[model samples]
Target: MYRRSFALVAALAAVLVLVPAALAARVHVRVEGKTQTIFGSTEPTLNVKANALDALDAASLAGEFYYHVAPTAFGPYVDQIGRYPALPGSPNGWVFKVNGIVPPVGADQVTVKDGDTVLWYWATFTGAAGPLTLEVETSIVRGKRCFFATGRNDAGRASRVRGVVFTLNSRRVGSRSGVLCTRLGRYAVRVAKAGAIRSRTYSGR
Candidate 1:
């Protein structure tokens, strides 16, 4: 009995030593809600603890937005964010993804590693499984400004986004040939479409 208790105590000591180091890790976070990008779109990279909810908590404190989490059967559920609430049969709600995947568990249950990207956005749901998301990438080469955009569903499946438009430095520009040759300089770029969550801003120099 004494040997078993000693082993248990050693295991607990190991866990206590590991947890604090993980909590200080850096995570890239983005909050998209309502009519515009709330945080991390044009802002700097965010710092978070070890879960998706921790990233949201950091954004809420830094951006000074209101959010509420409720204890549910599955786990902790984020029911309200900013001015939007996940109501019964209402379209206004929130959805989240870590590294482009909708995690099967709740945000608090999912453990996030360093450099993981956590994105939470307000979405209007149609049915049970709806509301697509967009991922954007930008690059500059030889004075040519280029963008690559893709749309992802709730399942993290990707497809090309149709009729993609870019907001570069607050100027709206449309792409016809899948590439824009705007003069390359330090700029911030965001992609949008007709019916998807707009992407987090990508800055290029």
Candidate 2:
């Protein structure tokens, strides 16, 4: 009886020691203000965190990305998946990849983590309802650092304006900075390391 009791205690101690270490190996991402774990045999995935409400309010903020309302060859860029209206109706909606390689809109539902990269862009609105705009900030899973871009109705609406910006610390790299700007409807930013980007964008007005 004594020998059997000792063996049971030893087995319980072994389990307690192993369980914590196993839990530490897992990782999670913050989406819509909720934390979720990533389960897979993969090392890297398109992992990013977003505060969807703030993203939609990016317009009307000055010095960011603003445009004028004018009906011409350029008004608003249409999305592929949702086909959401690109003007005053749903201005604070959708984030896309403008890196020329992959252009996807509406990243609110998409999940990304450390070592992941995202490119964001928007279009100008020109109609009887005036102009609309949008912005999106990207962050890594574990690091919690952030980088983002804002759109505006510049050029009075004949052209669509956009830009790309990012941070190095949030990317898990170091203190690094850069900026990618364009008025022709495209931009690019490089993901160098965990929290560093090829460029960054700052607004103070």
lDDT of each: 0.80, 0.30
Top model by TM-score, which number?
1
* Clash tally, candidates in order: 0, 25
Cα deviation of 187 in candidate 1 (Å)? 2.1
Tens digits of per-residue lDDT, candidate 2, 84-198, equal 2345455442233321122232334343333343333332224433232223334443443344443323221222223322333233323233222222322233222211112
lDDT of 2: 0.30
Candidate 1 structure quality by residue, lDDT tens digits, 92-188: 7787898888888889988877778888988876777757787776676776876778888888898877677888889988875445557768887
lDDT of 1: 0.80
Error of 1 at 203 (Å): 1.1
Candidate 1, run of 10 with poorest lDDT? 175-184
